[model samples]
Target: MELLKLHLIALFLLPTSTLGFNKCNFPAIFNFGDSNSDTGGLSAAFGQAPPPNGATFFHSPSGRYCDGRLLIDFIAESVGLPYLDAFLDSMGTNFRHGCNFATAGSTIRRQNTTIWQSGYSPISLDVQYLQFSDFITRSQNFREKGVFQNLFPEEDYFSRALYTFDIGQNDLTAGYKLNMSTEEVKAYVPDVLGQLSHVIKLIYGQGGRTVWVHNTGPVGCLPYVMDRFLVTAAQIDKHGCSSPYNDVSQYFNLKLRELVLQLREELPAAAITYVDVYAVKYSLISQAKKLGFENPFVACCGHGGKYNYNRFIKCGSKTVVNGTETVLAVSCKDPSTRISWDGTHFTEAANRWIFDQVVGGAFSDPPVSLKFACNKMNTSQK
Candidate 1:
């Protein structure tokens, strides 16, 4: 454990692009998470996302809440894989590279609980695992029937794949909405991490070896949170975010980092790394002007509020606002110059920038790029 800690510390000090590091490539990628990383899982299941959500890049809603691709989409592209299909969209879907099981409102724990009543409930991390297990079973059956014909001739695909997790934000946000105090909301961290650890262990037990876990981002900086909780001047930070909410997010990220380290010691053969999404996102906010963001505090799409966000009006709703009778939640002329999209999600431009930094290694623990970490496992085995 001490050696591992020293190794990680040393890696952190190295340049983002360390010379001699191999680029990691994987046969498949299975992602599990909430909206931040969700591609189309929720859309496939609930049909809630539509139109202008994907207008910026896709020119239409492709199930992504953002105006274009997500971090996971960029990650897949970086690893040389096609866009992953949603796990729920199984009909005629190709699982050659893998499928995404992340839904917009999924939590680390089950979503049917009373606490998640106000949250979106399509499938949670627990349910995602069940779906993955079922996929494995189906794949095995197809192999026996010679349906795969050698495409997936062996079970090695599962062992050699990359398992990515980006969950828990919903858990934290939902609890906060229930009026839980900082301490009260934080009390759920251990259980959330415990459940996450269980999922990682389960994946390892079933042959997954490389896992990349993303710590939650700066939830307070999100337009939705700021508009909802920090409307008053005293409650807002200099960046127009909710200071208390950001503090809670930091606390969660700290605990998650510790959990990742512990997992490294416990699962010696598995390559588990934590991604500091909070720092990456906060940088965009703090350096908004330098990053080309004309406005970081306001949503790129929404209506009827100071932050360009209205909870009741939403990003695509049509409603009356302050005597304006047919006001619709409209998008900005140029989403590329903004950070937040629809009050909660990031714009595609923002996601692209974040992905570039993430793949560069600075945001990851062990200080190695994600591609390097994935390649390290294969190189060690060889």
Candidate 2:
């Protein structure tokens, strides 16, 4: 009877070319981003501050800019993977599956001037890919295995594993806030796109075939900007999302789509998919009323009001004396009720729902459908 059971198990495990089996075979994820995808990694590198950064949930700062998980966390969950540890974290080096390289306040460009207050200097998308190259080399050496050994023992991991890049908001924000000339901004954009293209080439050069590249989002509408500019309540749309920001976001998204399409043509072997976070996030905000999100624009943490985040006052500061005015803010009753955990980041709930659209369904655009992107690589594996 035991022999029969073993035979049955072997029969069930026999390799088949079904899409479900192919989809389930993808091994791991490699991620890059700013605070949007950071998961307590920066804190591991920079240490944490009290009262402000993590006052809501972790009771102390946890590297992540938000009270809890970020978008990367949700994306990993959607794909049946563990919460990826920051590649920089001490415990992360041994993990074979996923490694996140996002840092809080990071932009697509290294020296983003927009939010200097956050003490954030992005790893730039170029640097991010360069680091990926280094990571591959080191991973091969440390494990004493070929680069693709753990990634794809069956020669299919490269095709099966997920690759995600979430960046660009910082680039647009820096360009606009720094008052860079239009020609300068326009010229700089191609360089940035060129850098992105180069990064895609590097990944493809290293055998990365399936990737999900996220475009920029509505930065102008962020509470930080709204409060800084003192935008009128009426200027904000019904969803409390600012229109100008959304418009700019749309433009950036359009350009990004064009760039990725070009990369696809250039790197024919890669199956790159574009995730339109702008539309996904916008649709989420539009449905906030029905989803029971009380304050789509209001931040769950930090000082509240028009700004939600006081760029001047700074969160977790002791500037306010006992007799002084209330400067420090509190988190909301239920963080789930809000779409934003801070003035600039998304709530866990919002992240999960958006992940559902991009990773869990057909909302992903270009290159090839995500389903094709993930499975195509495996099918081509030799």
The model with the greatest TM-score is: 1
lDDT of each candidate versus the true structure: 0.80, 0.65
Candidate 2, 305-361: lDDT as tens digits: 654776655555445577785546656667767887777887666776777665533
Instruction: State every prediction's TM-score relative to the real structure.
Output: 0.89, 0.80
TM-score of 2: 0.80
Error of 2 at 176 (Å): 2.6
RMSD of 2: 8.9
**Superposition error at 227 for model 1 (Å):** 1.9
Clashing pairs in 2: 40-64
User: Per-residue CA lDDT of candidate 1, range 1-382, in tens?
Assistant: 3324534564656544456665666888989998887878877776748667999878887888899999999988888988887887744567778878898878988755542357566588888999898888887789889796444324677887889999988888878777888799999889988999998898888888889989999888888887776556786777767788888899999898888877877887888877888888987888899767878878888986777988877777766778786638888999999998998899999999888877756667766777667643222100
